[model samples]
Target: MTEKPVLDSRAKVIIAACEMIGENPASTLSVRTVAARAGVSMGSLRHHFPTQRALRDAVLRTIYDVATSDDEVIYDRSVAPRERLVHCLRQILAPQVGDEARRAWTTVFDAFIATEPTDETRAAYLTMAAEGTRRMEHWLTVLDEEGALVPGDVRQHANFLNAVVNGVSIERALPTETSVLERETATLYQAVDAVLRAVDQ
Candidate 1:
C-alpha cells in the first residue's frame, strides 16, 4: 500500500496561507494570523518565511501553480490562433462579472483602497498585479511563438492587454444598461487583434 506523505511545518504554513488567500484574495496576510491558522508558533512561521513578503510570494506562487496546472487550452493548436488567444484572455475576465464582481471590488476597496495603506498592503497589491501581468505575458509569449503576433515587446503587449481587461472588468462591476458581455467580447477581440499579425487576424 502507498503511504500518504506527511506535511512538515513549512508545508503547513503554506497551506494555511493559501487557504486564507482562497477565502479572501484581497485580505492582508499578517504573520500572526497565518501562524495561528497554520497551528504553528510565530517563531516557526518566521523560520520558514522570514518576512510577510516572503510568505505572500510563496502563497501566490502556490496558487498560480495549482491554477495553471490543467490549462491545456493555451496549447491546443486546433483552434485558430486568434480565437485561441481570445479564449485564453477571456478566462482572466470571466470571474469579474455582475454581482460577484461588485462584491470582489468591494472587498478590494475595503482591503487595499479604503484603508490607510501600509507598506505591507502596498506590497501585497503590487505582487498580485505583477502576477496578473506575468500570466498575460505567458499567454502572449505562446501566441508569439505560434507566429500569430506582430513584432512588438511582449511585456508591453501583455501590460496593455492586462490594463484593457482590468478596465473592462471594473466596468462590468458597475451599473450598465447595455449588454456588458457583448461589449466585453468585442473589447477582448479588439485587444487581441491589435497584437496579432494581419494574416492571423
Candidate 2:
C-alpha cells in the first residue's frame, strides 16, 4: 500500500477540532473553530465532511488510529516471551498510561458512547480494538508453540489477556482514589499474571 499522507486536508481539520476539544473536554466541538485552526475555509471543511457527525466520525477514527498505532519504540525483542510480556506490561503501566493522554484520548470516545452511536463509529472503533486483539492472539500463539505459554487454546488465552489489559487500562484511566503513576501497579500486575497462568494451566 502507498504510504499514508502526513495528513489530508480533511484530516487536518479533524485534528484541529480534536485539539480544541482537548482544551476543554466539555466544550462543544463546532466546525467553525476547527476550520479556523486548520486554516481551511468552512466550505472546504464541509466539502470533505459535509456534516457535523461526519467530522466527528473522522476525528474518532483518528483517535483510534493514534491509540492503536505502533508508536511505541520497543528495541529489544531478543528476550523470552514472559520477559517480553513484562516489558510490554511496563510499557502500558508507564506514568502516561492514565494521565492526560488517556483522558484526552478517551474523551471523544466517551462522547461517542453517551447516546446511541452510529453504526460507522462502532465499526471503526471495534475494528481497531479487534486489531489489538488479533495482535495479542498472534503473540500468544507464537509463544505457546514455543512452549512459552502454559497451554490450552492460545487464541482464547490471548483474548483473556487482551481483556485484562484493556480493563486495567480503562480502570487506571478513571478518576481513581489514587494516581496510577505514583501508586503501585502491583494489583493489576498480579491480576494480569494470574490470568496468564490460568491460560497456561
Q: What are the candidates' C-alpha RMSDs?
A: 2.7, 7.1
TM-score of each: 0.85, 0.52
Clashing residue pairs, candidate 1? none
Lowest summed lDDT window (length 10), candidate 2: 68-77
* CA shift of 185, model 1, Å: 1.0
lDDT (0-100) at residue 92 of candidate 1? 70
**Candidate 1, TM-score vs. the true structure?**
0.85
The total of clashing pairs for model 2 equals 1
Estimate, for each residue in 1-201, the C-alpha lDDT of model 2 and write its tens digit: 899768778768977976864575434557788898998899999999898767766665565445444423222346545555544555444434557647745765665667576665565455545656655665565556656566577667667776776666676667777555434455445644653554332
